[model samples]
Every structure is written in structure tokens, then in C-alpha cells.
Target: MRRYLPSLSALHAFEAAARYMNFTRAADDLGLTQSGISRQIRNLEEFLGATLFHRSGPRLVLTETGANYYRNLALTLDRLEEISIDAVRGRSVDSSLMIGTHPTLASRWLPERLGAFIGSYPDIPLEVMPAMPSTDFETTQLDVAILRGVGTWLHARSIELFPEVLAVVASPALIPPGSKLDPLQFAEFPLLQNAGRPSLWLNWLRLAKLSYSGRIQGTRFAHHEMIINAAIHGLGLAVVPTFYIRQEVANGQLHMPFGEPVQSDDSYYLVYPERKFHNPNVIVFRDWLLRSLRKA
Candidate 1:
């Protein structure tokens, strides 16, 4: 006969206690009394024939074996929870897709082009979440994400959505009339910078073969919108993504003085976990996104 494993409830109690090193907190997390949680851990340890915790006064510490076991168990449990949640959510929604992306991209780029996607997949409901720096896709209920990076996704499989072409853009108001100065003359104005891409201005200048005294001097902002707004107001020239400022340029709010565009290694990518590739919702969303990019 094969041996039976302990119940999930007992294993969960043990994991919580091992993590917090406090029965009271574990009880709170599990919604059980401190004594009840203790009982569960004791039962689990007894069933396993090993001591999982060392009780020292009010504090609890994991033994060497307990530490090793907890490390492996926690990882397994986390993955299990992820899979369980995915399965449950997948069954609940047959035509809904959840996507996550940076706020700037969602605001400036996706809004204009998403109508095409909606037109093709009229039956599918697309849910977009503005993912912040701290958002983790594995823990969250996200089906896909559009991320900005140097084509590297640590855990997720990534596909290049678009290459970022950066250029020095300014309002027509800033340039003097009948003044056709060389590229180095750009150093005269206050430089607007993007905090996420500090080296953008320098890279663009280098690509234009322009030399300036204050190559690295500039005022930096966190979002691309702020940089564009500053440039539109004629505060200074900004190195911004061409796709982001397409509407502004068309409206004459911003002007790219340089005839050439500079391409950056960093670009937008569509990413999702390898396991989710076969999911119907994920597949539909990925295909729609790729098609939209192609049209753009």
C-alpha cells in the first residue's frame, strides 16, 4: 500500500506558521485561532514523523530540516495556487482576456489602436490593467502584458511588439525664424529628459553627430507624457519615442528638427508565461495584439 499525504489545510497551517514564525499571525492569516493553528502544525509534524518548528518562549524558529522543507514546499504551493487560480478563472470567462501594461503605453498608444482589435474580436471582452513597477504577473490574474525593456523577459516568453525610435522633438515656437543652426546649437535650450531613459538625449545627439557642452545636463521626469508636454510648451527639446508623439507632431504641437530617427535597443514587447500560450484567451489576445502591431 502507498502512504497518504497530509491534508492541504494542515500543510497550509504549517507553511504559514513557518513563514511568520508566530502562531498568532499564522492563525490570523488562516482565519483560525492561535491554538487551532498550533494543533494543525503539531498534527502535520506528527504525521510526517519530524519536528517542523522549535518553540522558544513566544517565538518560533524552523529547524534545519524544517527550513529546507519549507523552502521547497513554499515554492510548490505558490505554483499550485497560481495554476489553481488560472484554471478557475479560465473556466469562468470564455471570452474575456486580461492584459497588463505600463500607464504611458496604455494612455498614448493602445487607446488609439485598440478599436481595430475590438472590431475583429467583437465577442471577446478585453480587460486592460495599468501595471505598475511592483505588479507581478505570476501572482496577479493577468493573461498577457506589454512591457518596455531591452528585449529581455526574465520569466515570461516575449515577442517584440515595436522598436522604439527616439528623436529630439520641440515646439516650433522654440526655434528662431530664419535661424538654421547646426545640431550643436540645440544645447542652447533647456533639455527635457525622461527619467526611465536618461541616456536618450546623449544617444540621439551622438547619432546626429552633434557636440555640446552640456550633453548630460537636463531636467528629468518619470513619465514620457511629462517630457512631451514640456517640449510642447517650448520649455526645451525632449528625446521622445516617435510613436508616442505621432499625434502631437501631426497637430503641430511638437516638431522633430532632425531628419533622421535614432533607434534604441529598448522596445515594447508582448509577454506571457509559456504555460499560458496554449490557453484560448491568451492565444486570441496574442494574435490580436500581433495583428494590430502589424497594421500600425
Candidate 2:
């Protein structure tokens, strides 16, 4: 057995230098002077009884042994880092309840409803993760996700929260005086599109049994908030989700021209891994969420 277990500092220095292939750059990355990095690498090389670097005029090249050792050491260190992160996050993963949601839902809906949940379960700490629609829930530490889509997630139990309804809306200033425009007249205005749901305007039009070619041409935004802003700025008419824009409408920032909303196939859903259903926190959150939705 080789009696050399290299110092962790030296090993770290060697790994940094090996990755950059330049001592000065490695030193900058490690927040150490170039000389300090060089000494650490030398110490590591001596301990291993092998030459790790071939020093030229201003460049350091890895020897064959150095290359092989670095490959193994880099993999080992990466695994160790992953393990450490997993260990730390494991405590939260097991005890802390994480809820992932879309930005609009988190900002407009969840905050108002979470008070009751927090009050009911005083012992459980809730962590809200506002994530993108493309976030992978399995790899993430999130225990549950509230997503806006048709309930079709794989390997998870999903409960429908509510049906999403959308309508053509704009600021009061945008509605022209003496303009008694019906749903069909919506084609005349500059339409705004939600980039995430590009077909929203079309779907609403289809539901209304009206066909207009101009629905495809419009300003597009990735978030519901941006669409709301555009409508509020009198930029154009937007087909916005009713739940998200309720406050804006109530506050007179936005106006709904139509009497009825266009119902969408899309719905809000609460999803959790099947195995996590037994968790006490998950059970409490699911029950609270269902109750709140019912009350709403």
C-alpha cells in the first residue's frame, strides 16, 4: 500500500491547475497567488513520488501520469462534491416541504392562500420555488409542483385545481369611445400573445366560434405579467388568464370587454411523486390546497 494520502489543499490546488492548464489562472480562480498554487502542486507531486507537470517557458503541460491521475482525481472530487451537496439538501428534502410553481401562480395566487396553510401546520416549514415551466421536478429537491397544464404528468398523482378561463382585456384607455365591438371585432385590434401559450388567442377564438386570420400576428411575451403590462400600457389587447388579472381588473387597471370568459382546456394541477404521498407534510399540503381551491 502506498503510504501517501495527499493533503486536501494540495489536491485542490492540483485539480484547479490541471483544469485551467495555467498556474496564474488557477491562482486567480482559487483566490491565491501564483507562487502559492505552484508550491502546492509541487508538494502534491513530491508526495505522490511522480512528476505531474512539464514546465516550459511560461506554460505548464501535464505529463502522461499527471493526465491519468488528474482524470481520476477530478472524477473523485466531483463525486465528493455531489455527495456533499446531496447530504446537505437531503435534510431539507426529507423534512422541509418544497412547492414548485409558475411565477404568475406563485406571485398572484399562492401568497394569498398560504397563510391558512402555514397557520394550520405551524411545525412544517414551507419553501416555495418559483420555477420555469420546463423545470424537472424529479431531479430537483421539490416535493410537489403546482403546474398549469392538462393533468398528464408521468409517475405522479395529479389533482385538478381549477379550470383556467381567459378573456380579451385591455386598459380602459385602450377601449375606444362609442366602439361597440363584439368578440368578432377583436381581430381589428393589435393582439398580444403569451409566448408560453402561443395558441391561446386562437383557442379562445375557436371557442367563441369565430374565425379571423389576424390572430396569428401579434406581440408575444413569455410571461403573463408582461402581457398584462402590455395591455395596461395600451400597447394592444391581451388574452389573459382571469385568475391572474383579477386584481388588475378590480383595481381598474384592466377592463374586460366581453361579458363571458373563454374556457380553456388547460387547468391548474397539483402533482406529487406517488411515493411521497405517505409523507405527513405532503398529505397536509395536499389537503389544504384542495380545501382552499374548494373555498375559492
Candidate 3:
């Protein structure tokens, strides 16, 4: 580490501020006062010798330099978090939870809401990894997993956080308002694909009574957020879990083409090995997760 490298505290404040574009919200997320958040960002700007934000009458907008810096810094922070967790273990006995989850929940859902959970349990840092549909108790030393499935996993205890709801969403440019679209009408736009569930489109089409004359062709992405971003960019239509796209849909960046919500046979679940079911950390997280979900 060099003395010239920006401090992690200042960088973290800027990253949260950049992501939300609001100092007050960022301050709340970081558990700092509004003035404290502004001070930290100002310190970072001075250290970098470039203006990161244009503070315009109560609105904090990122400058071109800040926008570019934020983008790379965000990725850097994610990798740093992963590396930090991997290189270290619990600071003391029962002080952390080794978590496993899919990218969509981790990226779109957890990071934003994690501040509250951390604020409550500051001692138990989370060491998170990408998890499979079924937790690998034999191969991995994970304490818990957030998986998307029906309310069952062999040899594991589980609970459903919420039922998975899906919607056929795409960029509004692809499907304008008041368009009377038959099920097959959607085929006119290319279908984006999720590698985890290759048959998602087929099943949804079957339920919706849609038939396509042409082949469904589009890019395949491993993460749900990737497809959703592509859909927002007008690349193709995507059948995605509703929870993941609420913000985008609400912001009018994405539109529902079919105007009907699809209920999936599965849902998001928190699972852990039955043998370690009584672990205090796991139990606390499970309770907090369910309570938080209810509150949300």
C-alpha cells in the first residue's frame, strides 16, 4: 500500500454517493451524517486533484472524471471485498457468516440493503460466494446459502423468503405503449437468454400460449442482471424475476411487454446444512432475512 493511494473510507463514501447520486441517501446507507458524507467526498476530490462532483444547489451530480472513476472503482471494490473475505476468516469464533448466493440477488438486492443488516450486526462480516441451486455441504464450508428454488433442498433445512414473480420486460423502444401484442408478437424482438434456466422462455411461452415461427436467438448471460441490463438497452426482451427489475421498471427505463406477471414454480430461499442448523450466526441471519423481507 502506498501513501498516495486514496483512503478506503473516502473511496467507499464516494462509491455509495456515486451509485445513488444523492448524498443524504448515501449517508443513510453508510450510517453517517449528511455533512460527514460530504466531507469525505470532498477529501477524496482534493486528494485526486480533480473535481469528482458538481454540487449544484442541493443536487450532487458526478463529473465526467467522477463518472469514469466511479465505474472502475465500483468493480475494484467488489473484487477487493471478495479477496478480503477469501484471504481472511472470522476475526474470532462465530464472528462471521460464510454466505453463498446467485449474482442477481447479491448485486441487485443485497448490496443496497446490506447496510441495515451490517448496522445491526457489525461483528458478523459476510463472506459471500456464488452458490449452486443446492448447497454443497460435502465440498464447501459454507454456513448458509441464498438459493432460488422450490421450498426444498435435499439434506438441507430451508425457508422461502418470497414467491418468485416474473415479467416479460424490455426497453420501451422495443415495445411502445398501447401496443396490442399477441404472445407470438414478442418473437419479433430477439429473446435474451439466461444460462442458468435455458428453458425459461419456453415454459413462459407455453403458459402464455405463445408460439414462435422463428428460432429464439440472442446472447446468453450467466447473471440475471446482465440480461436485464441488455433488455434495458433494447438488445432483446427478457423474462426476469420481478423483484430484480422493480427499480428499473419504476424508473420507466424498462417496460412490460405482455402486461401480465408470471408466477414461477420456485422462489428465493435461505438454506443451510441440516447438521449445522443450530449455529447461532445462521439462525440470526435467517430470522433477520425473513423479518427484513416482510418489512420490505
Candidate 4:
């Protein structure tokens, strides 16, 4: 039985042409003449019985059908290329583990502990990518991810790592060394804010039982690391996760006047696609991560 599929050469030609929207550039990319790319795309369109491009325009444009086709086709081509490369290298289908995590955790917390994982499993290759906001396994090639939330992601199995512990810290110059902070005094100084987590200060205020009514005029930072750096420079008071600021506190760069750390409802979780529950690499990594963090 013949499969109803277009030729690989024609598909490649159309994909490249659609990506650059210029036959000359696509031909240059594939080391072929402009006519060759155009002919291949024409053949592909004829085979599929659909108009893939608008030739009447000043610049080449993909039709609605062509755009939809390209989106799915691109992902398929990428997966095919990955499998082909792995086959050429004589490795198993799932030979490597790609982990995605937030930039904050990757830069501050993970590096020191990664060495132990490498030393233990020298045979397993690893790649770390910065996954912002959230992880979508269907759209990404990551085998596992570390996320901060309540372990409620759809279609993913989440393993709780640790609950978030926050501490109110500021430069010693701003609050003075060895001075205790009163709950109401929180509104006295400028409050630095995390743009990503706007409710952090409000939540902390509620937990501390302080009803702040004074106006807060402070700079809002996009990243948590920036907020920590700003607090270190005596710009304002910042509430940061204790884990990320342990070194700063130990070195007296930041003073924690608020005595007790505040607990957050969210926890850090190691998550993977529910379908990957039986995958050997995912299992190995999950075990290693849980064990490593447990001892920390």
C-alpha cells in the first residue's frame, strides 16, 4: 500500500520557502537554484491539491492553509531530525535528559548541586534550558521541569520538592544592625517590589498582621535577583526566598530584621509529562533529584 505523503524533498523545499518567504533565500539555504525550490514547492502544492502561497502579492505570502500546515510540519520535521541523529549516533530513543527550570533557580540554586549529579551519572548527558512562566511539554522537548506552584499542572505528574520560605531582608544601613522590626513599621520604609509577583508584599503584610495604609513609592523590578540586588544596595526593603539569600545573610550583606521567616503556600515541584511515567531516563532523574534535594 502506498502512503499518502508528499516527497521529502518537496516538503523540505516548501518548509524553507515558507520560513524565509523568498525563493532566492530558500534556494541559497538549501544550496539549490531558485527555480529548483519553486518547482519543488509547486509539485508539493499540486500533490496536496491546495494553494500554498499567494503569487499575486509584491512579497510571497503563505495562505491560511499553508500557515497551519507549516506549524505542525515544522514540529514533525524537528522530531524526525532528532530521531535520525540519535539513530546515527547508535543511542537509544530516549538517551538524554533535558531539564527546564526558571532562571532564578538555575542561576542561584542548581549549579552547585549539578556537579554531584554529573559525577554520579557521567554516562547520562544533560541539558538545562530556561523555561519561563510555565512549562508546556506538548510544545517543548524538555523531559522534565522544575516549577514553583501548587503542583496542579495539567497532564503532568508533579513531585513536591520543598515549600517556599520567605524572609524580609534589607541592607544594614537602611535598618541598622541588630535592630528588631515591628510589624507596623513595614510601611515606614520604601518597599521594593517583584513585578512578576505583585502580591508578595500584600501577602506578607497580611501574614504579619500589619494593615499598611501609607503610600509605598518604590521601584518595581522584573526579576527576583534584581530585587535582591536592589535591597543589598540599601535602596529598600525586599522579601526574598531564604534559600536564594542564605549567602548574602551569612556574609552580613543583608540584615533580616523580621526575625521569623514567612511560609508561602506554593512549593517547588519536579514535574514531567504524565505519559512519561514509565520512561527510564525520567525515572532515573526523578529519583536523583528527590534524593539530592531531600539531603539538602
Candidate 5:
């Protein structure tokens, strides 16, 4: 028998106790008495020759070693539960693929293209979640994420899908017939802004080799989709990603006042945990995504 291998009951007790940081709550969760929970944890600690918790009155706090152990153990327990559930259901261990991405990509880019991936792999259950705040494999169950960034995420593998190419666009009504406006002239109009990228207008002006001292004032929106929609309604000139407004531009809903799209330093990337490099679902989705984008 392995000396380091603690009993399942002790492990469960420690996990529950650490999570709640209250032995009574842990006992209630596991249908055990408070003392029973305490005894299990104590025995486990003695077995490991390490104090896992610091008891101060009624409150319990995890020690440094305990915190590290809990993080890894929690993940292991979650994976074990998933595998057990799959086994009971008579399916593969990893039966689902959860993808996290921004709303812009989810609504505009993915909705039209998801069907192809679904058609190719019917067995893998798919769930698309909004990558709110930030996506972290350690903290989230997401198998993969499509994020807009410079292609660098800690403890994760990232592959750039495409560089962010921006273009100055406005409603056709905003731009008169056969009229070309220079950078300074275009700045005179109401310039819509993306709240996330507040420096976009200033950067574009500097990139265009012009310095405007006026404060950039407009209705700022959180997402590019909102900016595009606002631009279509003739609110103001919106600088948006060129690829995002392709259909809008082609269908005469929005018009580009600029000659060519400006490439940004950031790019959209397919990011995933380094551990999931060999995941079949991720691989299939990655390949399909690249092929689809190339065709588009």
C-alpha cells in the first residue's frame, strides 16, 4: 500500500472542509457530524505529517501547503467526477467541448459557421459561453477560448487566427456623394468610440500622420458590434474591424471613408490550456476554424 495515498473519506472531508472553511458546513454537506469531519481531517493531516488548516475560534483557514494542495485536488476531483459520469452514461471521458469567446465573435462570426463544426462532429457536445472578464483554464471549465489580444496568455497555448485590421466606417448618409475627406476633415464629424479601446481614435490619427488637439467626444459603446450598429444608424463615424463589417459594407449599409484598412498590433487567437494540446475536439475545431476563415 502507498503511504502517501490517503483514504477517500479523508480526502473528501478535507476538500469539503477547505472549500467551506467551516467544518460544520462541510459536515452538513457530506451528511457527517462536525466531529466526524474534524477527525477525518486530523487523521489525514497526521498521515501526511502536515497541518492543513489553521483553526481560529469557529473560522478555519487553509495553510499555504493546504491551499496549493486544494487547488490541484479540486481539479482532480472535478475531472474524476466528469469521468465517472461519462462512464455511467456509457460515453467517452471528455464528451463535451466548452468554448468561451466575446459576444462580437459569438454573434457575428460563429453563429453562421458553427453548423459546419457540429455537422462534422456530432458526438462532442458543444457549449458557447461569453468570455466575460477573462478566461482561465485553472478557474474555468472552458476547453478553448477565442480572445482578442496580442497572442500571449499565461500557462496557455495560443494560435493567432487573424490580425485585427481596422477601417474607418460610417453610414452612407454621413458621407456625401463623390466627397473624400482627409484625416483632419474626418475628425470634425462626431467620432464614435469603443469604450474598451479609448485610444483608438488618437492612435489612428497619429498613425495617419496628423495631430489633433481637440478632445475626442462621442457616445462610447462597449463592443464593436454596438459601434457598427450605431454607425449604420448615422450616429457617428465608427472605426471598426474591417472583417466585422464586410456584409454591412457590401450591402450598402455602411461606407468606408478611408482608402485602406489599418492593421492593428492585436489579433484574435484560439487559446487553450497547454494540457489540452492533444484534445481531439479542440484539434478538429482549430483546423476547421482555420480552413473556414481562409475560405471566407
Candidate 6:
């Protein structure tokens, strides 16, 4: 038994005619003569065994059945178009965004807030990759990157998230029993450092208008979080971004000695290639990030 189906061309003819409700306009759209469009529409109505259009008077109007069929057929055509585009592109019809972020944001900032994005875009799959913010976008699959910087990324568009504040923190055991800490005493304890940010302590001191003549050095680490951990274990006093250790400060895992937080010249930024300015995935993530971070 042959399933009921008409020539795709005939269905397209009827759809176009139903769209304009005028055979002449539909014929012009499909690059066919009005007679050809009328013939195709007739073939379609004959196959369906239904009068799709009322032939009363010269004005053509879709019948009740034809109007209902047109609604469902329009949806089917849209789905078919999406499937065709996705098949050619080899990607999900529902967009998927790959984000690159540094360890601090990826571990501390993003984890708590990403669920909102997931909830909003349940249809869009999102993947967060721990990567340097300045990683090459041309060579990577990452659609967007969130990283800390002074906001001058050439060839990339950026939106400022928040300013960074560095503070001197230490384990409780490292501080001696005293009310006022002699600024010079800072040199006595091993200064925890991250090789990636060797100037953090120097710049922080400069901002505080304090100077240490002694060698400001200690166990160097590649990652910022590791420096925080070293300071927590009493290995040394560490200078870190105040934002990363909010819970630690509240829970007494780390203590900030008497001093104001040092504000860096840089801030965290959400960035992507300028070429991706209008990419759907990047646009949604960018808007979501700005709203989420700015609100908090």
C-alpha cells in the first residue's frame, strides 16, 4: 500500500499560494506561470481529496480544512529548513556554546552562577573549559572567554565584569599576638607568590604606600588558587584577589591583616573575537554574564 504523499513541488506550490492567497504572486515567487501554479495546486487538491480553496467568485480564500493544514504545514516546513541547515553545518540545530575561563573564575565565580544560564537555555548545551583568557580564539573552538585584564584586548570585543581587589591574607598561626602590625614585619614571613603574577606583592605595596626593602619572595606557584592554599596552610602570607576567598574569609580559613584591599588597574572581562559579535551563542552568553555579574 502506498502511503499518501504528493510531489514535493506540488506541496510547495500550494504552500506558496496559501501564503499570498493569490496564484499569480505564488507563481511569480516560484518562477512559474500562473497556469502552472494552478495546475500544481489542482494536482495537490486531487491527491488530498479535499477542496483546499473556495472557488466562489474570483477571490480565492483557504477553506477551513485548508487553513488548518496550512498552519501545520508551515511548522513542518520550518522544521525541515532547520534540519537541512543543521545537516549541512554538522552542528546542533539547538546552539551549543563553549566557554573558556581562567581557573579562578571557572572554579570560584562561574560554578555558583552557571545554573541560571542552564535553566534559561535548557535547549542550548554549554561547556566550560579551564583556559587562559588570552587564548587564541582563531585556533580554538571556544565561543567566548571570561578573564581578568586591563580591558585592552586587541582584535577582541570586551565587556567589563568587575574590578579586582588584592589583599594580604595569612593563616591565623602566622600572625604574632599584636594589635598593630609593623609594616616591616611583612618581610619577616615568607611571602607566598605566583610566578604568573610576580608583581602582585610589589604593586600591592606600592598602592598601600608601604615599602619593604627585604627580598619579597617565597614558594612560587603557577596557579593563583595554589598560592591561596599555601597561605592557608601557614606556608606563607599570600596576596590574592578578595573575591576568590569570600567563603574562606567568612569561615576563618584565611584572615586579612589590617589594611585596605588593593584595587588593581585591571578587571575581569567577558571577551570574544570581534568577528563573533553577532554569533547567537556568544550573544546569549555575553548578555547572561553581564546581567548575572552586574546584578550580583
- Provide the lDDT at 70 for model 6: 80
List where candidate 6 sits over 4 angstroms from the true fold.
Answer: 1-94, 176-179
Task: Please report the TM-score between candidate 6 and the true structure.
Answer: 0.66
**Comparing candidate 2 with candidate 5, which one achieves the higher TM-score?**
5
- Alpha carbon deviation, residue 250, candidate 6 (Å): 0.8
TM-score of 2: 0.68
TM-score winner: 4
Could you tell me which residue pairs clash in candidate 5? Answer: none
Range of the 10 consecutive residues with the lowest summed lDDT in candidate 2? 132-141
For candidate 4, the per-residue lDDT at 284 reads 86
- Each prediction's Cα RMSD? 7.9, 9.6, 15.4, 7.1, 7.5, 20.3
Q: Which stretches of candidate 4 lie over 4 Å from their true place?
A: 1-93
Error of 4 at 284 (Å): 1.0
Candidate 1 residues 1-296, lDDT tens each?
A: 87688889898998888877888999999999999998998898899899888977767889988988787777678768767766977744435787888778888888777787788878778788876533444444567888877666544678888887888787889964345656676777888878876778777876666676564677888988888888888888888889888888888888767555788767788888665778887887788778766775
lDDT of 6 by residue, 1-296 (tens): 98778898998998899878899999999999999999998998898989899876899999998988886776577567768867998976548787888877788878888899999989787778887755644334467888888876766888888898988888888874334676556787788888888998888888788866767778899877788788888899888989998998888888877566888888988888776788988888888877887688
The parts of candidate 1 lying over 4 Å away from their true place are 1-95, 132-140, 176-179, 209-215
Clashes of 4: 0
lDDT of 3 at 146: 85
**Candidate 3: residue 109 Cα off by (Å):** 1.0
| Every candidate's lDDT | 0.78, 0.81, 0.82, 0.84, 0.84, 0.81
| TM-score of each candidate structure, all chains considered together | 0.66, 0.68, 0.67, 0.72, 0.70, 0.66
lDDT of 2: 0.81
Angstrom error at residue 230, model 6: 1.5
For candidate 4, write residues 39-151 as lDDT tens digits.
Answer: 99999999999999997658898999998898678768868987997889887547788888887788889888889988999888888988754665544567888888998
